[model samples]
Target: MKQSTDKIAVLIISAIKGGGAERSVLTLGQGFHELGYKVHILRFKSLTEYDLNPNLAYHLLKFKPYKLIPNERFRHKLFARAIDNFIEKKIGKPDIILSNLEPSDRVMVHSKLPNIMYIIRNNISNKFRLTDNNKLENKISKLQNIYRKHPCVCVSKGVENDLQARLGPHITSTTIYNPFDKQLIKQMSNELYSTPHSVLKPNQYIVHVGSFTYQKAHDVLLKAYAQSSKAYPLVLLGKGKMFDETKALAKSLGIDDKVIFLGFNKNPYPYMKHSRGLVLSSRFEGFVRVIPEALTLDTPVISTDCPSGPSEMLPASSLVPVDDIDALAIKMKELMAEPQSFRVSLDESFLPKNIAQQYIDYLTS
Candidate 1:
């Protein structure tokens, strides 16, 4: 499939939440825009946590009446219909549609739009395991059937393999790693903060940036940090439902004084740049964006060898067994002892422009 001059691409996701999936969608939109395509982001709501590209257009599916309906199934059906109508009337038909997240994917699949590409940004099986609701399970089962009928993009080889194992090989899918804008990260990291965070002392603290959640396994990180002999404070960035619980865990581990909970900072790049090292303790991830982002800043990283991403992004020596407090503690100690020795350049394959081209090829193909 050759590129068309008048191509129009529409990227759909539930909302602009501060997560890897949202960031990936934003990066892809920018990529498509750079390729001379008219990019439009179709979101279900107007709520956003991350910044959007100025070049890309934005469309919203305004269906507030769906909330009035008491029945869940019928509400979803109406929501899907509303999306289809909005796309037809407001945006018309796009040359290509890229859908992210389950809610948006469900609507896209239900719309039965042509040239629809569903992006699997996480380990679906692990996500499903995170919940036990029968209704949600049924919804996911339906989404899986819809996913089978469309071309899909997985963020990593491990994610691609996991999807195939669950949905079978009949599904057409391709692996495209997430893009990292190294120059942009460096530029942002250099921006001076009006008020410097007191916790960010020079080479005195390691950083961990992610939502405070069970999947991130902050407990494991806290336990590991507690066991380690390093004196550097652990600075945690990002907020979530488990923020208080994680704080309590740190206190219980007797490392509260050494751990600084900064909540969420819009610009964590500066912190990443100044930190001695970054740590990711996810139990499973589709792809850990922080790994490459940290490496881009010339910061050493120690991560758990989770199901899909850490091993793929970091050297084997820098990865420890998942959820093994002792192993993570040992790795943390080694990293803190010689953080400079562990620093390595990220592979050029993850360059933003290169990965962006891969997306264009996949979408066009």
Candidate 2:
């Protein structure tokens, strides 16, 4: 489809109010506005705290149609229907509707509008997993038949492969890694770096910034941190059901004293900047966005070589085998002993200005 020349209105939808996917949408909205396009955000619920460029305009839809579904079995079907109505009514047929999360994404693509292009940006790895239960074939068909035949941009190559393998190469998806604002990253880094080490307190602390969820493998992270003989603090930043379970696990490991659950803090950069190194123990990722942010902040990183992201994000020498407590611990140890050399080779592709250009191309072309 040829790129439309108009005001270029874009409507984005997401499930939750925060996290990497939410932040990515907000950053892109700001970038879109900077490119002189009109942008609007339609969220299912409400945001606790979020940052968006003040100039950008948005609309919020607050409804629990997903909750009204008789049960979880056909909940996705009902949720998609609800979003369809919202797009038809409030959205008023934008140039494009961008769905960034599950259920909502399925709905937007299923609308089958010819004038309005539906762009579904895959936010999780499980959505594209090839399996009978996943219903990938049916979903792909629905997308192609319904939406105005726009591209499906998976955030990571692993996600792209899973889609291609299950749905076949004919569906061809693009892998667009998330972009970061290099200037903002450098600004944040400089601001954090200038703070006195005495005030920031260079305590023996390792930071993990992500929701307390299964994909994050926080259980394994806490366990690995517990096994560390080196006496250092392990700080977790995020709120979820797993928070309590993780606390109990720490207590059971007899290392609860070493773990500090900071809950969710708006500004984690200061803590991340002053920490020994950032640790990520995810089962899989499109690309772990936080790892790059940590590197930008000059924080050394110790991550599990999880499917798709870590091996690509970090050098072969920097990654530990996924779910291997011993390997994770060893890398953590190595980083703590010699941090500067490890961070010198950080990747620059994620910088915001570079990423903004990619979005501009997507929107314009």
Candidate 3:
């Protein structure tokens, strides 16, 4: 499976929508492009919002999945053909194909494409525990079938272990921690942020950067914030279905005025830079990027010791128990009182070029 430097690598994803997974795809595209691969992002849906790279290419090929077909295999095969045909016409045959998210995996596993692999960005087993408790084994059997078709690359070791612990040794996959351009993140964090309302002052507010989703456990954060010392305002950055609901929760907690909801800024690094510290209270996570992102800006950070990610990079002092409001509140008070930031001691293997090479090597080997 070895290839020349000028090879084509098509990244299949749901959309270029914002989130950690989407950001990872775009950043990896740059990594592939930099390595002299003709990198292209082929999204089934056209929900674009993130900053695009000039060196990379993107194609939106929307096709209706044949769900009405009686046979599951036949319909998925038909869908995969549409994806293959889209690549055949839009670009030359790709040297390798990497699919991300559940949307792509739903059909791309049936794809007869070349050297295809799936990138797992979530705690799949934990998600099953939350969503499919009644028929967990059957759901895992379905996933086992998917892995049999194309191997996977998990974003964290905990994610890999969780899958293997359930799916067993028969699965084909490896862990590759998410890559970050630290200097770029630091540079962007230096940019001054202007707001329409009262401005955000440096070291005067506590910040949390995550979409208002159940997975983010915003309710826990709100409860904990209300119990904290309230030395600084709590700034919530990001927007989703849970936005209004989270706002309502803040009001219910009687901390509405003390909580700031700044919905979905393209760049949240400045807020991370200026905040006293960052907090992530996710119920589960793949790789908590903000934990490291805040560390990159030298901002003190704390997170729930969720299923994955946090403990991998964060020291014990920076972690609180998942879904524990009291524990989080105590730590929140600690952060407000102290200005200490952790040293960014991430692995050099997490660099873009190194990570890109690892992907290539994984496919070739």
Best by lDDT: 3
The residue-by-residue lDDT of candidate 1 on 1-365, one tens digit each, is 22445677888888888887887788777777767777889888788887677988898775566779898567767787777676666666677788897777666666756778888888878856856686666756665687887888999889899988777777899999988777778999997753245766768789899999888999999999999985688999999999999999998988898888887776789989988999888898999899889999999998999889888877888888889999999888887888986787898777655776787787677
Residue-by-residue lDDT tens digits, candidate 2, 1-365: 22334444455565435577776676666665666666667776665456555766666665465668676546655665665666556555565556665545555554554333333343333654554756866666665454324566666777667656645556645766776665665565545433322323564677899888887888888777766655567777888768899889889988876677778765577778778888888877767778877877778887888767667667877788878988777777776676664673466666544554564566557
Model 3 Cα lDDT, one tens digit per residue, 267-316: 89999988888888999999978887777777888889998999999899
Which should have the higher lDDT, number 2 or number 3? 3
> What is candidate 2's CA lDDT for residue 117?
34
- RMSD in angstroms, candidate 2? 4.8
* TM-score-best of 2 and 3: 3
Instruction: Please give the RMSD to the true structure for each candidate, in Å.
Output: 3.1, 4.8, 2.5
Alpha carbon lDDT of residue 72, candidate 1? 58
Candidate ordering by lDDT (highest first): 3, 1, 2
Off by over 4 Å in 2: 1-6, 65-93, 112-149, 185-200, 344-349, 360-365
Computed on alpha carbons, the lDDT of every model, listed in order, comes to 0.82, 0.65, 0.84
Model 1 weakest 10-residue run by lDDT: 193-202
